[model samples]
Target: MVSDVLLGELAALAVLSPAAAFAALGAYLLLLRTPSERVVSRAVLSALSVSLAASLAIWGSAVAAPYAFVPVKLGHWFATRSYAFELVLLVDRLSATMMVLVSLIALTVGRFSVAYLHREPGFARFFLLLALFSTGMLALVSAGTVDLLFAGWELVGATSVLLVAFFHEREAPPRAAVRVYITYRLCDVGLLGGAVLMHDLAHSSQWGEVFGGAPWPGAAASLGPGAATALALCLFLAAMGKSAQFPLGSWLPRAMEGPTPSSALFYGAISVHAGVYLMLRVAPLLQRSPAASAVIACVGAATAVYGTTVGRVQADVKSALAHATMTQVGLMFVEIGLGLYWLALVHLFAHACLRCLQMLRAPSALRDAQEIRAAHAGEPLPPLGLAARVLPAALVRRAYWLALDRFHLEALQERLVAAPLMRLGRVLDRLERRWVAALSGWPERAAVEPGEPDAHAPGAPERAMAFEPAASDRKGART
Candidate 1:
């Protein structure tokens, strides 16, 4: 949907192209993907690069207006009940900033993935997820509703899970992917419930409609403050899950098992920022709930302090980046909590770009440092040895150790999620055996084959077959 507006067309490109390119790339790579190569991955990377440029142009253009502006629309059929309000690519100040941040991060990480995942097994798969993530990020900014925005939000989670387990042969990658999924699912539930509440109250799902004072169909013109606040809390809970805020905050640190490109793209930038994006998207509605806003602020502040402290303890390059992402995200929450939505957008934008770069570069930087240490054993690399001015090494070390433990959330997961699953699994196994036995017949028994010896068998080798000539040969001989 190109428009007379130069900015709108660009926004359309950002919203639509990445998904299309990735889908095409995915198709091409289906025949070509192997451990040795991933054809056309580069093209998807280039698409994201172009998208990043477009995103920035739009951001710069839209930043002039603080409230919503830059309108463009496209419609798609999502299902029978609801027709897609596809793209109303509005780049009000908040969305503009988010667009720039997401595109930049997607572009940088796309570039990094090219080299880092070259000749790696999941190259095409990685690009597919990455491209989809890029598209979702852009589309999310373009979304004008809780529904459309959620559609985009879901793609981010789906793609992130695949990216997290990109190196599935390893033990850790699978575990990390599962954990990310579990947390994301929980978050989605809250988000969906809140969306229902919003629709019930506002009569329409569109952000403009709900916050702009449209009531739900057949509903009253006025909603109770308590109801609005409840909905706000529900949305905030979703934000906490997606953003890695307290309690739900621990998943990001363990998500480093994926390829570094994913570490850069999903965890470091767009994926982690999804929560903040949601929070900012509903800023108008959330503003009505002072209780919700205070909670958001409290969680964000706590996460910032906790993440920074824990980040001090991380020795791994990716782990450090994960912690950094959490710390910055927490700061963004602070911005949202404090009513400085636009300023938070700036932090989200700036931090996404910087963190992606930092994450993309970290592996090489650490390698170079290691090389230096090897080449000059006794000498200090002055910068590497310096501790943060605000926090000393001792405290950092202590915090790092605790952070490395992720405050034992893994153990808590076993109690809350895993142990129950294990018990359920045993029940399933029992059910399976009973069902299978009940479901089976003689065919199944025959398929199992008789382990028992035949009655004719007597622990002796069977007699060799008697040699016999063909009947025609015998007749010919007789004649």
Candidate 2:
């Protein structure tokens, strides 16, 4: 019983340690001046260190009893007659493994950033976001209920967008951040919808309730084919956005605008694999629904192909590595769809380590290449695997053009989706202004439109007042 209590406390600490650090840092930034660089770095590292220790302890306990499942119930947030929201954390082999991975990687990144971002203006802000991200990721992996998972998922998404736009002064970073935000917002509908469906179908959103009390990979969800398919696809939609698969993946390479440590922590390692983790968590749903599995496999295969083809044509080292990461994540998704859950997990862990190292080294890649060329006496290197050598010239040229242009995915998305939505927003804004003018007894022509000069501006003609104070009141005020 004492051991159980200790394990539960450790699980809670694993999540709350980083959260407390984030709160402290955020408070300092808001109520007081930003802390010194050393202070910020040490605070973040200390938080992650504590989290890592707690996670390692949990992992040790899990190892002692292999495949151990421990659910720590904090309490119920609210309870309705038909529905109750509970806060629960699950520490099993899967979540414990993920917790250790997240904590270790975040700790390493935090330490690396102390030097990498030295003397930078936004150093404190970057560490603050990193701490918040650690908390979110820990919460995500340990969440035993869909509601808690969604909260963590949003935290991860929000922080990812902010980090991608870390250099907010730059034009490109903000634009890329917007693109990522849009993709996440659209895909998050799947997670929310899936949660609602789970509640309605299972009478609860708890994993134990939805998938039975058996352990993962063996637990079978008690749901029919149609219901399982709907839920699985919805959840997979959320995964697709987070994972940066295929058509939704253009925002990833652009996300390289952030600092290297953030790039490594988010895109290369933890954040990118979040979707696959979600899928693995619900493996039984896919097993129940063949249609869902087939769709997942097909999309994963297409994303792998797309990533490989485009990755080859990227001019920059970071973009190429981003696409390579995407290809590997795509294959992991395929593994999950094929019901190779353990293999997918192993692949995820190994790939995350490799990709994080590559992202951190990306800035030095060009210098390394130049040094190699210098050592070779400036001799022109042979094109060892040029497509031109084997393929027809015309076909090779066409393929190169397609790959270079990223198959026009961005252009097509703008034309079909973004452009129309923007026009509609503009129209809605004009209509809202007209309605406000009508209700306020102002002339329709006097209504302000977007991008137009305001009538209240200094140089513009003043509009007639809708009302005036009484003359007696005005005279009293003067007196």
Candidate 3:
């Protein structure tokens, strides 16, 4: 067996490498020092490469030994009267495998971006965010406590929104970023709520304490059914928002407004799969709650069907690919619900790699299509299989229309959820405005009686009479 100290060092390196790179690049950019594109790319890739090596070594040692997981604690971050936070990191089969994938994909994406965005404005900014994302993803995968995971989760979300707004000069990118940010905030409630419940139920935020100290993929859950159900539901809400399940799915396609490299890394590879990884990590909790598992299954199935229908009718390649990614991620969710934990992990890794490749090559799609047509002597390609071959003509037509409209899911969301929230927001704004006006004395001016003469009005009798008393009093005092 490897020494515990060696393993701890390796784990620390795996988490810190990308963070160090992020810090260095961010400092340089903030100081307004222009860094060469090659230097930026190399720095980011080198850090990720180191992280990948450390993660692989850890994974190899764990496999050689009898332990299913290895954990390390750097130090305590802070301590409260009731709760103490620690800077802990863990590596198991799951996290190690994901680390390898994340580093490799990031390296590829970073390399691609160095050229794809050559001489473009914000080139340094792009690498900075990419490095930040790498750090966040690694931290999240290895986090030993819900509190730690939440911190990593937030970092990933922030970088994602920023990447979506990479083209800040464009109107669409900012709008898309805002939409995604709103969705993230709404969905984050679940993660925060779940973390609170976990602390209350287990008396600790550590994964080991919460799950009875068992290794992942085989946790002996300690939380009761009730607690587990509530926690899982909260997490599911978070997952739906992050993974773009069903009604929240519109933002995924709109997120294509960013550069291709960002698009590939985020939606195709890392960010979109974060929620799935979270669920897999907490599989034991879901296993304990039948109600939560049922909800997960139902939602996964609905999202998968929804993604397929919408993907079929998307006019643009990127949008179509986004929906397709949502479909596969939904299947992964189903696998988790069915207790096929390892299968879900495998699916996530495989799908992420494949989708990233497809998205990266999307810009050349027209050229590829032309080549294919030429090879086929300009003949039209045959249709792939149809789902409604035996259905009546009218029914098929109706289904096609529904698919074209993405089943009206976006409209439903705006009407049922967004509209009510927007109205509530306006009402709150109005109330706040009135409160401010009252505090600033505007309300008193607005409340002036119409019959009362204006104090400053020219030739007003009331104004003259009001000043005459004061003037006479001053004169009497002087005399």
lDDT winner: 2
lDDT of each: 0.71, 0.88, 0.84
Model 2 ranges with Cα > 4 A deviation: 80-82, 374-391, 427-449, 452-479
Rank list by lDDT: 2, 3, 1
TM-score of each: 0.76, 0.90, 0.90
TM-score order, best first, reads: 3, 2, 1
Candidate 2 to native Cα RMSD, angstroms? 8.7
Expressed as tens digits, the lDDT of each residue in 281-387 for candidate 3 is 88889889878888888888888998987788777889889999999999988888899998999899999999999999998887887898899897888766476
> What are the runs in model 3 whose C-alpha is more than 4 Å off?
433-479
When summed lDDT is taken over every stretch of 10 residues in candidate 1, the lowest stretch is 470-479
Give the per-residue lDDT of model 1 (tens digit) for 328-421: 8998998888888878877877787788778778768777767888888878656643445567879867766666676776568767876798
